[model samples]
Target: MEILSTPQGDFELSRFPIRSKETLRAWDAADEYLIKVLHEEQLLTSDSNVLILNDSFGALSCSFSATRPVVVSDSFIAYQGLLENLQRNNIDQNNIEFRDSLREYGEVDQPYNLVLLKITKSLAQLEDQLHRIRPHIDKNTRIIASGMVKGIHNSTLQLFESIIGTTTTSLARKKARLIFSQFNPELTPPQNSYPKTYTLESTDYKILNHANVFSRERLDIGTRFLIENLPVSDHYQDIVDLGCGNGIVGLMAASANPAATINFVDESYMAVASAKENFTKAFPDREANFYATDCLKGILPSSCDLILNNPPFHQQNAIGDFIAVQMFKESFIALKPGGELWVIGNRHLGYHVKLKRLFGNCITVASNKKFVILKAIKN
Candidate 1:
């Protein structure tokens, strides 16, 4: 396991759901660079309520948890990593504030003096987040956003100026650069009209997405397979669509099992938004529970009867099974006695072993050459 050592402490991080041969750890050079700059200038203090944006892993927040930092990120996997990493390193979570990007508008009541922004591939969505953050910004609020050199495009700088303030770039260290910006008191950013819509003919519904939803333009193939191979569960009282991107699996589940109450959960604000819209369009009369969460972290234990997942294999550029494993563990914890979890995944990923370990029983419900639908029954 690769440990990311920072000035604050050493963090042993991995891509969620552990992997046998994964090459990437949770922290990156950008994280190190960000921490370096923060320490170099003493930007972090005990009283500072730092809002960390887009921390891919808990690298930034975990190191600064002692400072009572509030972590705000758009990635479910990243949020998951933060919690697991905090646990893995034995860091008390009393000071941490985990805020999902989708529900960021909800946290406007809490004011933060300093914010740490880490730019990702979703720059367009980042712009919207910044705009929403305008009302929350004050004169003393300083933002330091960083990313790998490749992630820092000209438009990234332009978007910072458009939404936050004047920007300056730090020299690249290990191919990562930081964008330092001060809030512009004169500029007031407008509200973003998100939940972008796209219609799907197969399900015959129009999906709404917040900016961070995956494959917002069209459906992903893994989800299509899961929807096609959905199981008929007579005993399922409460069902959850884990990583319910765009709400496709959960929507299909609700359509098939109208009697069951479906809970749709995702980390992305856009994903939750899209799922809500799709649910309304697909089953307008039904009221379903939808949440933008970091995996199943906040879900009540031993509550759900069934969980459906099309687990993601990567968080950003790093490819691994850490996330899927975490989801499996969470599902097991959240499931009632004898409850079941259904999942569809690329066969190459071999999710069966993880399921077997967590649930004590694993079976191949259905399979194609490239993909397999696996089921785990909680014992």
Candidate 2:
């Protein structure tokens, strides 16, 4: 593996699930440009406490190791990548504190002199993160956020102005632009509103989308199909809803098998938070495990009897089956003997081959013209 050299240090990085040959690297040109600007400007100091947000793979954080930085991001995979990168390069993990998007930001009581922002597609989420960081900034604090040219928009600048202060973009470097902003004093943040409701004939489940959830609108079509055709289980006692966005699959499973305990897992804090809220609203009296995890990373092996997943095929701006493949492979490791893993995916993705490779047997349970639901049993 090639080491990514930055101002912080040189480190090796890889995509999650440990593919032998990944088409993409964790760091990008935008990351390099941001580090270049930071170095050229000498923006950070030993006394400077930095908050790095939306760092896709700890590139910004790892690059800025000169000043012990605190990293915050929405993606659980990003978080995993950061830690693994740090460990791979022999960077002291204790030097940086990693915070996920699910937790409250106010916990960082120390004032921040610098904040490195990485723009996400969700402007609402970016605004919320900025609003939460407001209380910790002083007038002289410098906030530098960057993203690919395609992600920067007028609304992106507007959100920065609303939460931080007036902003301006730098010239594009490697097709990326940086948004520079000053601290805004005496600004009142908008109310933190969440757990949005969406009513549909398929299910009356309330969507608990935080700032950075997937398809925060109505029900996603794949989820709708999975919910409509959920399998009936008579003997399964333990269940897992992998990538349980808004807890739809686990919610439905709970409703069908009232006696079965379900574990809802997703890497996104926003998704898990929303799932928790939906679980509370839908299964008010039921008890279950809801966690913001990187797939089944923290799950004990051979503990689950059944796993239902609508695995994501993409991460950030890239589209691929690496995530889904990892989830299936991980599910196989985490399931008990004879335990079954149920999944739904777009037919064009050819998830059947992936599952067959992992589970040794894959069966098509249901299908439509666009989607196919498959079930694979652990040996």
Candidate 3:
């Protein structure tokens, strides 16, 4: 990634996942456009107190490190990227503060003079952020949001107006646009609509979901297929739920295999938190491990007898199999010899082919019109 030339200072940026020679740049034109708007509006200063929301990486934070900005984001990888990128440039670590969006840290002790916003893929998440930050904004606070023109939509602007009041837009530059919103005294603070729960007809308990988890409202079709066809065996002891969203897979695994210990891992703090809540609600006395991680990257190899996965094909706005392929590779590396890796995916994704390539053998456990449940055994 190129060094970002901002009014505060030029700083380097990197993507969260840390892929080498990656074609995608960490920060996009929206980031640069936001900086330009800030400079034009004379908002950047040493005395300015800044709160940066949803900075994909550390671009905005690093650029404004002098003002000691507070950075709040949802992805654990985004938090890691902030630290790594700050270290990459040898910037003073004391200049920035970090917080996860899953936590109740939106209410600030002191009001911020300037807020830089980068709209994320989840409008639910954006609404939640706006709802939380409503009390913190005043007449003097400047809230400016920027994103790719493709990302900004009519509803996006409508959200700004509904929450922050009297929102407006800027001319497109380099395929990016800015939204300027001012505080409205009349609009009521938005209510929190997330952490919703829905019951599963197949199960006795309901699953909880935070705003941004995949298919938060209900069971996804892929996982739904996996559940109806989940293999039952007494041979497994240690089990893992890779990319466990609300931990339905691991919970079901636990119920089926009473003697086994189950581990649930996901990158989102909210997902892990939701999984933990659901696990406790479903089986309070049952022992389980919930981890927030980037796949099974740091998990000890050959430590599990079975791994169940419904890996995501997308990371933010970009859709591809990079993450799912990486998850498959990680599962292969982490499973014990002769251990089973079970997966549920869309048939068109060709996950069976990739699993066969990595695990040496793949079996179609079940299938439907749109999804296929496949299993692979470690060689």
Candidate 4:
């Protein structure tokens, strides 16, 4: 854990699923800048009902835990981090409220006094958030957003202006910038176009994707490659789609293996919801399990006969193979003896090495110039 020194107070913080020899700090320059500005400018009042959006860890929420802020995020891992940090800091769990990003905020009783937004990689998600929070703010509400300078661009600023109101930015400090958007009471944002739908190629299946889901606009090349090479068979009675984005991979596997039951799992609440919807729409009579979890943490040991995965190489903004490593380890434990784990990834990721290390053997199933499909058996 690292100490985040802020004007309010210094708090110990760490990223979710704390790793050994972790090099990344939980809070970033933008988090520090936002905290500094809040205290220096006297933006936060004791009675302020603050709403924090997209706090990667618990940095913002933990720093302002005394305010009893309402925190909104779509990531299960992020939520876990927030809870862990709050408990580690001895903060009262009841002091804060948590909400998922997919739902509307009609149940909120009063307008927010302040809204803190941490810009994300998904522009669609940011747009959807602005539309959702628009009704909860008024002309008096203070809207402040922060991100690394590289992450904020003309398109990002334009999104703010089009959705919230007149938007402005601050001088960069430590490569981090802050955005100030005045809530315009008269402006009506465009209708939310999230949960996009598209038909899978050469199939009648309709795939539904939420705003934050990866490759929501279309089938990502890696996933498309994996789908074309699925090892569908009746012998694999139980199957799992690890990191199942919209359930297309699992849906296709189920289509070919009619007698097998498929399980769809992803960390994103929105992704799981989309997958659940898409799977149900495709097979109304078939039964399946959907989980929004941290990489099969609660799944039964040696329960799955086959696991299909297109492991993500990054977690949030930090890009690495740590997520894929974790998924492989989990797949190893969840697979029964003689069970198989199939993965498709870019050739540069070197997933075969990790799969070999965990499963003791790995074989190439198919390959193209950019992507490779590999299979490992738990023997």
lDDT, candidate 1, 1-379, per-residue tens? 6788888878887666466776667778888998998899998888886777777778888888887776777766676777788898898877787776765542565666788888888766777778766666677887888889998898989877877888899899999999987789887555565657777656557777777787776777777787888877678779999988788889888878878999999877667877887888788788889887767978899999989998877667765787788899999999999888998989888899888877778999888878899999988
**Which candidate leads in TM-score?**
4
Q: Model 1 reaches what TM-score against the true structure?
A: 0.72
Positional deviation of residue 341's Cα in model 2 after best superposition, in angstroms: 2.1
Q: Is candidate 1 or candidate 3 better by lDDT?
A: 3
Worst 10 residues of 4 by lDDT: 101-110
The parts of candidate 2 lying over 4 Å away from their true place are: 7-9, 106-110, 186-195, 199-204
Query: Which candidate has the highest lDDT of all?
Result: 4
- lDDT by residue (1-379, candidate 3, tens digit) is 6677777777777787777767787788999999887878788787987889888778888887888988888787787888889998888888988877766544555777888889988888888888766777788889989999998999998888888899999999999999999998788755678888899766678888888777888888888878777767888888999998888888888888888889999988888888899999988888899888889967899988999999887886657888999988988889999889998888898999899988878999888899888999998
* Cα shift from native, residue 29, model 1 (Å): 0.9
Put down candidate 2 lDDT per residue, 1-379, tens digits, no spaces: 6678876667787756466766788877788889989888988778888888888877777777668887888887788878887778778888788877756553455678898888887777887788778887888889898899998999888877877887898999889988899877866656654435676455676666777776676778998898888766776788999998778788888888888888989888888888888888887888899887878988899999899999887786668887888899899999999899989998998999988988889999999999999999998
User: lDDT of model 1 at residue 347?
Assistant: 89
Q: Report the poorest 10 consecutive residues by lDDT, candidate 2.
A: 192-201
lDDT of 4 at 70: 91
Q: Give the CA lDDT, 0 to 100, for residue 132 in model 1.
A: 66
Q: Which stretches of candidate 3 lie over 4 Å from their true place?
A: 106-109
Residues 1-379 of candidate 4 have per-residue lDDT tens digits of 7899988788899998988998899989999999999999999988998999999999999989888999999999999999999999999989889998887653565889899999998889998899898889888899999999989999999889989999999999999999999998788777888879999999998889999998999999989999899997778999999999888999999998999999999999999999999999989999999998999888899999999999987897878999999999999999999999999999998999999998999999999999999999999
Q: Residue-pair clashes per candidate, as listed? A: 7, 1, 0, 0
Tell me how far the alpha carbon of residue 114 in candidate 1 is from the true structure, in angstroms, after superposition: 2.1
Model 4 residue 345 CA deviation in Å: 1.1
